[model samples]
Target: MTISPQDLLAAASHSKAWPFQEAQRLAKRLPEGKPGGVLFETGYGPSGLPHIGTFQEVLRTSLVRRAYEVLTGGVATRLVAFSDDLDGLRKVPGNVPNQAMLAEHLGKPLSRIPDPFEKYESFAAHNNAMLRDFLDRFGFDYEFVSSSDCYNSGRFDDALRAVLANFQAILDIMLPTLGEERRRTYSPIMPISPTTGAVLQVPVEVVDAAQGIIRFTDADGSVVQQSALGGMAKCQWKVDWAMRWVALGVDYEMYGKDLTDSGIQSGKIARVLGGNKPEGLIYELFLDAKGEKISKTKGNGLSIEQWLTYGSEESLGFYIFANPKSAKQLHAGVIPKAVDDYWQFRAAIPGQDVDKRLGNPVWHLLRANARHEGADAPGQGETLPVPFSLLLNLVGVLGASATREAVWSYLGNYVADADPAAHPALDALVDKALAYNRDFVAPTLAKRAPAGGEVAALRALDAALAAADPATSAEDLQTIVYEIGKQPEFGFESLRDWFKALYETLLGSEQGPRMGSFIALYGIEPTRRLIAEALARA
Candidate 1:
C-alpha cells in the first residue's frame, strides 16, 4: 500500500515529537472518508517577487497531497495554489520601480497595475509568472487558479452572493468577538485598505457579468464602480478567502503564523457561508539572515530567484523539509551546511548503519542519488565526483572555459587531475559531481561568465599552458611554477601570489582544487591548446 496524505498526517499526529499542535488539531477536524478527500489550497497575493516562503506553502501542501495519494493507492487529494491577484495594493514594496503607482492602485486589484518588469502586462501577472516558474522548476504538479481568472469566470458569483447575504451574520459574530475599535474597522468580508485606512466599499448594482463590471455605492450613496475585467473583481481580502474555500471547495489550507488570528476569523466566515471550514495549518515565519521575518513590502525577504541562484534545488527543499511548522526563524547562511549535511546523510544511509534519528526521507534521497550514480555508463566511473565537490571544482574550471573547446579542455584537465590511487569513494564523489555539474551547473554557467580577475586568471593559465612542455606532468609543472613563486619578491609559500598572477593574466580563481588532479582528468594536450587559444584572445 502507498503512503497517503492521511497516513502521513496520522503518523505526524501520533508522533510524540511532532511540533505542530495546530496541524494535529486541523487533521483531527477533517471529515471521515476516503471519498471526496481533502482539497489542499494555499493562497498567495501576487504583488512582488514570490519568496521562498511562498514556495514552501505550496510545497508543504503538495507533500500532504503526495502522502494521501500514496496511502490511498489512488490520487486522493488535490493541491491548488490560488493566486490572489485581485487583491488591492496594501503598500508599495520597497524595491518596486514605481512607488507613485501604489497610490493609484490603492483600493484596486494588483492585476490592474502596469508590470514593472514589462514582460507581463500587469504587476500581478509578473509575480504570478515568477511563482509559476518557481513551482514548475521544483517539479510540483499543482492546479493554479488565479483570482482574476476565477472571478471573471463567475466561479465566485454564488459564493460572493452567499457572503454578501450573510454579511450581517458575519458582522454579528465578529463584533462581539472583536474589540470595539477593531469591530468597527472590520467588515464581514473585505479587508480595509492598510494604506488609505479606509473601508473598501464593494460596488453594488453594476453586476454585468458579460462586461465584467460591478457597480458599488459609496457611504454617501454615490455611484462607485470597478470591473472584474481580465478575470478579476474587487473582493475584500478576508472575505475572498472564505469565498474561495466555498467556490473552489477547498478542504485544507495552511497559513503563516502571522495569520493565525485571521485564520480563526476566516473559519467563522466559512461557517456563515454554510460550507465546511477548510482545515487550517499555520506555519511559522521564515526569517532572513538577520533574523527578522521575511516581508515583501519591506524588501526584507529572500526571493526564490536569489535562493535558486545561490543554492541547489535540494538545498531549498531541505530547508522546507527540515523546518518545523512553528514560530521559528530560518537563516539563509544555514543553507550550505544543510546541503552538505543532506549529501552526507544521503551517502551514509546505503549499506551503512542507519541512524534511527536521520529518518527515511534522508535515506530515500541517498538511495536515489546512489541509483543514479550506479546507472552511468561503465568505465566512466573515475570521471565522476560528488555533487558539491563538482560545484566547487566547476567554480574553478568554468572561470577559464569561454568556449566549447575551452570547456572540453578543462574537462580533460579535470580527468587528468584525478589520482587513480585515490579511494573508490573519491571516484563515487567525482561521479556525483559530474552528474550535478552536467545537470545543474552548466545551465547556470552558460548564462553568464565570471568577471574581473577570475577571467584574467583563466586567460593567464591558458597562456602559461601554451608555453609549457607538453610532456610535463601537471604536478611537476605546478611544482616548477610554485618554485618560481618561492623567490623573495613573491614571498614564502605564496600559492595566493601565484594564483593572483594566474587569475590577473588568465581570468580564473587563484586557488582551486588540486591542479594535478584536475589536469590528469583533463588531458594535457587539450588544456594546452585551449589555454593557448584563450591567451591569444586576451
Candidate 2:
C-alpha cells in the first residue's frame, strides 16, 4: 500500500482542499530560495485571554504552512505568533477580576497595565503567556514575539521611519473611514505621553520625518515632542497592522470575516508604506449557541479546556478544519456531533483515492498530530472501535454511576478486542462518554409510562424475545422487532415511530442505537427484563 512520489505529486496538484489552495497562493508569493525560507504570521491582541478564535487562527495557519512545504517540495517555514501588547487597553474585559483597578488603567498600553489576575507582570503579559502555553500543549510549532519588545528594542525602527515618511499617505487612506468627530482629532500616529504614559488620541501638532519625531498634546494639557521611533509612538491599529507586515516581512496571514474591511484598509496602507500586503484569508467567525458572534470579553464561547473535556484534541482540530469559511456554533452542544463527524471522516480515509484522501479534513489534522505524537504516519481511521454516537448511547444505557470496569465488561462482550491496552483511544473515549453523559445526558433522562397501545406492543415484544432462540444474531432480533412494528395491530405508521415509542418509554431519549444491536449488546434476557420493568413502571 505504498504511495510513490508520482502519486503524491499528482494528487497534490489536483487537490482542492482549502489549505492547499491557501498554500498555493503563498507559494507564488514567496520567491524561490529566498533567505529565511518563508515566514507565516498570526496576530494576537492581548486585550483578553486567548479563545477558540486564537486557536483557530494558529491551527489553520499551521495547516497551510504544512501544505506549503509539501507543495514546494519541503521549503522551510517559520510561524511567528505576534502579540500586540503595546496597544492601549480601551475597555476592561468582563471576564477578568479587579474591574475598578482595570478601569483605572484604561487608555494605557496593555503591557503597562497591572495584571488583575496577579499571574504575570502585566495584563498583556498574562494573556500572551497564556497564548503560548495553550499552543505548546497542542504541539504547535511557533515563535512568540511581544509588540512591546519589538517596539522598544528598535526592531521596528526602520518601519517606523517608513511610516513617518508616508504619514500623509496613510492619513489619506484612513481619514475617509472615520466619523467627523474622530476625523477632527485622528492622526495615523499616536504618541505615548511623556508624563502620563498613555497612548494619546490627541491631534498631531507636528511631524518630523527627518528626526522620526511626532508632536502632540498630552492628556495633562502639555505639548510633547517624542521620537516616533523606539516605542515612543505607535500607529493606529489599521496603520499598525500594515506597519507590522512591513516590519516582519510577513508572507502569509489570515484573519476572521469581521476584519475584511480592516484587511482592505491595511493593504492600502501597506502599499503606502512601500510594502505589499501579505497573502491573506478571511475565515468566518465562530458564534455562540444563540447564533451571535462569540466574544472573548463576554466569555460567550467554549474555551479550549471546556471543549476538550468532552471531545478529543483531534476532534477539535477536525471541527476547525471543516469548511472554515462557514460560521459554526461554539458550545458544549456542538462537541458530540463534531466528535461523531471526526469519526465519520476518519472512517472514509481508507477507502478514498489519493486525491480524495488529500481533500479529506481528517488527513491533514491526523497526520499533523500523528507526527507530533511521534508516529511515522496516521492510521486509516482504526483509532476508535465504535462510533461516538453509539458510545454516547451506550453510556446512556449504563447510567451515570456506572464504573469504567462495568462499562469495559459490557464492551468486552460486544467487541472481542476491547481490551484497554489494545484500544487506548477507545478507552479514552469511554471516559469522555462517561463525562458527557454525566453532564448533559443524565439530568434529562426521564423514562415514562407507556401510553395506550404501547403497553400491548411492549408485551408482544417481550413475548417475541422470549420465544426467539438464545443464539439469534442482533440482526435476527432486529428483524423480529421490525416485523412486530410492521403489524397492523401495533398501530405504528412506520418502524421509526415504533422505535420512537420504545426510546421514550424505555430509554427516555429521542434517539438511540439500533434496537437489534442494543438487544444483542445488552443480552436477550436483560432486554426482556427491561421491557417487563418499563411495563411495570406504568
Candidate 3:
C-alpha cells in the first residue's frame, strides 16, 4: 500500500516516537484494496480520578491517529479510549470526597463502588465520565469503551473462550515471570464471586477447556464451577491486553515503559490465539519535579485540570511531543516553556517544507481539526506580535488586576510595529499568560536585593537611560542593555543572565517582556526610576 501525502512519511522519518515509526511500517504493510479503516486503542484503569498520565495516553494515541490519517490521505480511522472499569479497587484514594465511603467498597470491582462524590452511578463511571468530559472538551475524536459493558454484553465471549482453550499456552507465557508463591495460585481467569461479588483470584482446581468452564475454591471454601464467559470471568491483565487487541482489531497503541515486559508477553499470546497483535510504542513515564514517578494516588505532578487551568490544550499537546521515550519532569515550572515553545514552532513552519509539516507539533496543535485549508502554514493564523513569555512577564509587571483588554493594549503599544488585533490567538494567549501568572507567578512574586555587581550595573544602566537622547529608538535601547551586559564588573556570564537579573530585580518575576521594547514603551523616565530603586536596594 502506498502511504499518501508524502508529509506523513517525512514526519515518521523525523519522529523519535517508536509508535510513529511503527505506524509508517504498518501503513506500508496494509493489504492493497479498500481499507477497512485504522483503529488505535488507549486504555485507562478507572481506579482513581483520571489524571495527567491518563491524558498522555489518549494524547499520544491521537498523535499516531493524526499520522495515520495523513498517510492514508484521510482514510477512515477510529481511536478507542477504552476504560478498564472492571478493574478491582485495590485501595481507597485519600484525595476523593468521603474516604470512609470508599473503604466500604474496597475489594470490589471499581464498576461496583459507589461514587464517593455522589455524581455518577459508580466510582468507575464517575472517573470514566470525567475522562470523556475532558476528551470532549479538547475536541478529541474518539469512541469511548467500557470494559464492564464489553464483558457483560458478551462481546468478549469469543476472546474469553480463546484464552480458556489455550490456558496452558498462556500459563507457559506467564508462570515463569512470577515468584514461587504467585505462580502457585495464578489463573488466567479471575472468577467473579457469586456470594461476595468480589473478583476471585484463587487457584483453579479444574480447567474444562472443552466446556469453557473453570472450577476454583471460593472464599467460603466451596468449589465453585463458573463458566469462563461474559461477566462471570475476566482474564488477567496481560491476557486481557492481548484479547482486546484481537477483539477490537486495533492497528496501533502506545504504552508506558513500565509495561514493556507485559506487552512482549501479550504479543506472544495474541499471535498464538490467532489474533493480530497491534504494534505499540513504549514511552517513559512522567516524573514529578523531584524526579519521582507521577502517581495519581500520591498526587506528585500537575493534574489535568491544573494544567488546563494554567495553560492551553495546545501547550499540553506540545509538552507530550518530540521525546516520548525520554524521561521528563512534568510540573508547573515547565508550563511556561511549553507555551512559548509552541508559539516558536508555529512561527517557524511557513519558511520550510509545507509537505513535511506533518512532523511539526504545531501542525497537529493548530490544525488538528482542519477547519480551514492551509492551516498547517504558520502564516494562516494571526501571529503573535510578541512571544508568550513577554506577555506572561507583562502579567507580572502590571499585576494581576490587569484585564485581557489592558494586557492587549499594553502589547499593542509595546510592539508598536505590529497589530494586536491581527493575531487571532491573542485572546487565548492572554488568558494563558494571566492564568500562569496567577498560579506560578503571583504567589512567588517578590523583589530580591541585587548583588554588589548588579548594583553597579544598574547604576550604569540608569545613567544611560537618564542621559540618552529622547529620540532613542527601541533598537538603540536594546543595544544599551546588551552593552551593559558585556561589562566585566557586573560578572554577567551573558546577555541572558543580565536580562534575568533585570527581570527579577524590577518585575519580581524570573522572566518578563523583552527589555528593549519594554524600556521603549515605559519610556526613559520610568525605566530610570525602576533602575534607581533597584540600585538603592542593592
Which candidate has the highest lDDT of all?
2
TM-score of each: 0.60, 0.93, 0.87
- Please give me the total number of clashing residue pairs in predicted model 2: 0
Instruction: Flag the better candidate by TM-score, 2 or 3.
Output: 2
Comparing 1 and 2 on lDDT, the stronger one: 2
RMSD of each: 10.8, 2.5, 3.9
| lDDT comparing candidate 3 with the true structure | 0.77
> Candidate 3 deviates by what RMSD?
3.9
What's the C-alpha lDDT at position 45 in model 2?
A: 91
lDDT of each: 0.56, 0.83, 0.77
How do the residues 263-364 of candidate 2 rate in per-residue lDDT, one tens digit apiece?
999999999888899997899988899999887567697888888889898888888898889999888888887887887887787777778778888878
The local lDDT score (0 to 100) that residue 45 gets in candidate 3 is 84
Q: Which residue ranges in model 3 land beyond 4 Å of their true spot?
A: 1-20, 31-35, 205-211, 367-381, 399-409, 415-424, 442-460, 463-473, 483-513, 521-523
Q: State, as a TM-score between 0 and 1, how close model 2 is to the true structure.
A: 0.93
lDDT per residue for candidate 3 within 237-346, as digits (tens), equals: 99999998988888888899999998999999898788877866789988999999987558687877788777777788798876788998989888878877887777
Off by over 4 Å in 2: 31-33, 98-100, 296-299, 369-380, 451-453, 467-476, 487-489
Looking at candidate 1, the ten consecutive residues that score lowest on lDDT are: 367-376
